[model samples]
Target: MKTALFELADQVLFQNYGKRDLALVRGEGVYLYDDQGKRYLDFTAGIAVCNLGHAHPGVTDVIERQARQLLHVSNLFLIEGQVALAEKLTQLAQRGGEAYRAMFVNTGTEANEGALKLARRYQYVNGHAEKTRVVALPNSFHGRTMGSLSVTSNPKYREGMTPLVPGFEVAETYEQAVEMLDDRTAACIVEVVQGEAGVRPVDEDLLRRLAARAKELGALLIVDEVQTGVGRTGRFFGYEHFGLSPDIITMAKGLGNGIPVGAILAKQKVADAFTPGLHGSTFGGNPFAMAVANYVVEVVRDPGFLERVRQVGEALRTVLEAHFERVTGLGLMWGFDVEDAASWRKRAAERGLLVTVCGPKRIRLVPPLILEEAHVQEFEAIVTQMSRA
Candidate 1:
C-alpha cells in the first residue's frame, strides 16, 4: 500500500538519489512513521545529520522561536548568533596552543570549497603563488561541488564530470598521497575516518607522517570532518582522536542536527589571508541557521554528553561485531559488511529497523547520538530475528 505521493515524487523530482519504496511521513525520537502508519526504528538518522534524533523538542523550540524572532537577514549585518557559534567552534577547535577562527556556509561542499580557496590565498599572500596544487588521499569523499569534487578521490564520483578543477589531483595510493606533499602543494586534505570507504579509519602512522610533511613543506593540512565532527566520533572533532591539529577544518553533517549549516575553521595565521572581499555566502550565517547550530554545539560539547555516546557506541559495536564481519568505525558511527546490502536493508525495514547501505556489501550505521543502551538491546533483538529469518 503505497501512496500516489511516491509516484508523484518520481514523476516530478530529479531522480538523482536512489530511494527506497517506503515513504516516511513523520518522525519522533528514533522512530519514523510511514503513510500507512507502520513504525520504523530509525538507525540512519537522515544520513547522520539528525545527531540529536528526529523531531527533537529542543531543536523544534529553537526553530519556532527563531522563526518568530528573526528568520533571515543579509550577511551585511553583524549576527550575534553567528559570532557566538563561531566562538564556540573555534574554541573547541583550539589545539596545541594555536587558536582557530571560523566562517559559516550552508553545506559540507561549500565549507570545503571555501577552505580550498583559503588555502591557495594564504599561500599567495605569503609569496608562494605557485603553491596551488591540492593533494588528496585515495578513497576519500569530500563533496559534490566542483572544487570539493576535484579533491575527492573516488573516480565513480567524477563520472560525466571530468576535466575537474585543474591542479587538483588524487594520489595513486594512500601512501603516495603524503609522499606527494611538497612546497608546490597548497594543501593536503584527508578524512580521519574515510566514511565512504566502508568506515575505514585512516592509518594513524600515515596521518602523522602527512601532518609532519605538510608542516615541513609549508602545505596546509586540511581535515574534512563533515561526517565526523560535532562529537560524532566521541571527540569534539575527529582529528582530536589522533591529536593532529589541522591547519584548516571543514565540517557540516552533524553540526546543526538536521538544519543545514557548515563551517570552515582555520588557524588565525592562515585565516588572515582571506580579506574582506575574498569569499562570501549569501545566506550562510542567517539568524535562523545560526540559532539552531549554536544550540547543537552547546549540547554536543558537554563532556558528560560525549562520554555517554562512547559507552553506548561500544555497546552497539559489540552487537554488530557478533553478527557481522569487519564491523568498524568510531563513536556512534559504524560500518559492517553484509551480503547484498540493499536486500539486507529492505529486510531490516520489514522488521521495523532502518539502516543505510553505503556500498553493495557495506552497511553503515550512524544512529543518533542520543541512542541509549536500551536501544542497542532493541537493535540486537531485531538483528537476532533477522538472523533467524
Candidate 2:
C-alpha cells in the first residue's frame, strides 16, 4: 500500500516536496501509525498544524458536526461561523478592548498577502501614497506566494523566482532596519521567532526599537506570527511576549488545529483600508474551517491550557539541554543544534520518532500542544539512546 501510494503520488502530485518513505495511515493523540502499523511519536505535529494533537476529540467532533451541516459558501454571504471566529480572534488579539478586525484566509501565506495589501492600502488611503517600500529581516520565512516571497530573505527559495515584487528590502542590521523605515516604507514584516531559519527567537530589544521606529516613521509594523501564534509561544500571539501592539498581525499554523484556517488581525484604522472590492478570498472564511477554528481558539486561549504549554516547554528544554549541545526556542517550539541534522533526522525516524531538520544543522521540535510529560520522556529516551550510539 505504501509503495502504491508513493507511485500514485509521483504520477499525480506535483514534484515539489521531498517525499518521505513512510506513509501514515492513522493518528491518535501524539502518535502516528504508518501503513505497516508502526507507531511513531509525532514531534513535527504536521509542521505545527495539529496543535491539539492528531484527531483530537474536540477538533474531530467540530469537523464532523460542521461537515454534516455546511462546508463552503462564497464570501458574499454572511457566515455565522466565520463571524464567530473573527470575533473570538479580535477579542484575543486585543485584550485591552482596542478596536480590531479580522480577515480570514485559508493559509498562512494568504494571511500574509492580505496583511501586505492592508499595509499598502492603509498607507495609500492615509495620504502616504509613496509609502510602498517593505522591510523584512534577513532569515525570515513568510510564505511561498510571490507577494510574501518577495519579503522572504532566503536566497534558496528566492533564487529562481527573481524580479520579485519591487520595493522589498532586506534589513541586514538593526540600524539598517531603522533606516529602511523611512517615509517611503509601507510596512516592516517580521516573525517573532524565525521558524524555518532554525527556530531562533527575535531579539526583544531590536524588535521593540523597530516597532517604535516604524510607528514614528508612519510605517505599519506587521508581525508575521504564522508559526509563533496560536499559543505556540505560550501566548495567544507571540508579539505579546515582546510587548508589541502591531498595526497588523498574521497567523495560520495551529489556528484550526489541522483545519486550514488563517487570518490577519489588524487595528481598526488599518483594517478599514481594505474596502469590499479591494481584497477578497473565494473560500477564505468557509463555515467548516471557521467552525473548527472557533473551537481551537476557545481551547488555545484558555489561561490554564497556555500555562500548561509553558510548563511543558520548560521541562522539554531542560531535558534537551542535558543531551544536546545547544537548544533555543519558546513554549513548545524548539530547535537543537546537531552535528549532522539530516543524518540525525534519518536515525531518529528509524527509531520511531518524527522530526524536521532546518537550516544546516538544527533539528526543530514543534510538537502538539496536547503533548504530555510522558511524551517528552519518551523523546528524551530516544535522544539518550541515539547519543550513546
Candidate 3:
C-alpha cells in the first residue's frame, strides 16, 4: 500500500528533487514516523530548517497562536511583530561589532537577493554605480533564485539557467578573489563553510584577507550565513568563528523554526543604500512570520542552548570522524566524507534514520540543537554499523 502511494507521488510531483519514497505523517523531537507507524531518527532536521526540532511544543504553540491571530499582511503598515523581530535580530548582530540593521524577507534565496541588491545600491548611493561586479567563491551554495543563482558557483545547478545575472564571477582562492576585485567590484560574498559544496570550511586567514581587501577596494564584505547561522555553528553567526565583522550578513533557514523567513543584516551606513521605495515585497516582514521568528530567536538566543549544541556537535563529530575519512563543521552543522553518501542515505533510511547527502560522498548531519547525547549516539551507531556492512 505504501509502495503504491510512493509510486503515485513520483508520477505526480515534479522530478526536480531527488526525494525518498518514505512518506512522513508526523514528527516529534528528533524523530519522524511514516503512515505505518515506522519511526526514523531525524538527523537532517528538515535540511537544517527545523532547528528547534520537529513540532517543538514552544515553537508549535507560538505558530498556532500567531496563525490564529494573523497570518500575513502587506509591508505598507508598521507591523508590531516585524518591528520586534528586527529589534531582536539587530541585537544578535551587534554581538561582535556595531548594531546592524535587518531587512526581512521569505527564504534564504530572498535574503541573498536583498543582500545583493543592497550591495549594488550601496555603491550607487555612495556615488559608485559603475562598481557592480560581485565576487563569490567556487562550489558555494546560496540558494536557487535567479539573483542568488547568479552568484552560486556550481555549474551543475546553474547550467540550465543560462545568461545568469551579470556582474558575478567565481573566485577559488584568496589570490583569485583579490584579482577579481577592481574598481567595478561592489562586494565579495562567501560562505564561511560551503554547506552544499560538502561542508568545506574556508580558511580563516583567507577570510581575514578577503575582509581586508574588501575594505581596501571599498567594497562591502557579505557573509552568506544562511546555513551556518542561528547557533548552528556554535555561534549566532558563522563570522564569529573568525573574529571578523562582515559589512553585510544574509540569513534564513532556522530563523523562524520552520516558518519561511529570511533577513539581511547590514552595517548602518551600507544599510542606508536602499531608500524607502527602492525595493519591497508584499509578504516580507508579515506579522505571523515575524512573530514566529521572534519566538525562534528567543529560544536559540539562550546562552546555554548554543553551548549544548557545541558539546553535542563535538561528540557527534568525534564519533563520525572515527568511521569516516573526514568530519567537519561547527556546532550542529556537521558533515562527513563517507565512501558513498547515496547508498548510505538509502541504507540509513531503511534502518529508520533520516540523513542528507551534499555531494556523491559528503553526508550532511544537521540535527536539531535541542537533540540530546542519546540521539547523537543512536545516529552514530546507525551510521557506524551501516558503514561497516
Estimate the overall C-alpha local distance difference test score of candidate 3. 0.86
Model 1 residue 44 distance off true place after TM-score fit, in angstroms? 1.0
lDDT tens digits, residue span 67-104, model 1: 99997887889999989999899998984569899999
lDDT of 1 at 39: 96
Worst 10 residues of 2 by lDDT: 171-180
- Estimate the TM-score of every prediction: 0.98, 0.98, 0.97
Give one digit per residue, the lDDT tens place, for model 2 in 1-389. Answer: 35688888888988878776888889999999998888999999999899999888988988899999999988989999888988888888888946899988989999998899899999999998999999998888899899999988888888888899989888876568777788899999999899998998989999998999998899999999889999998888888999889899999989988778899999999999998799998888899989999999999999999999999999999998998877889999999999999999989988999999896789999999988999999999998899889
After superposition, candidate 3 runs with Cα above 4 Å error: none
Q: For residues 1-389, write the lDDT of model 3, one tens digit per residue.
A: 55787788788988787766778999998899998899999988888889988899998888889879988768878899878888888888887577788888888999898899899999998899899999998787888888889888888888878898899778776578877888899999999988898787889988898888889989999999899988888888888898778899999898987888888889999888888999888888898888888988898889899899889988888888787787788888877886788998889998888989999988888888888999878987887778677
Better of 1 and 2 by lDDT: 1
> Which pairs, if any, clash in model 2?
none
- Candidate number achieving the greatest TM-score relative to the actual structure: 1
- Which window of ten consecutive residues has the lowest lDDT sum in model 1? 15-24
Ranking by TM-score: 1, 2, 3
Backbone clashes in candidate 2 total: 0
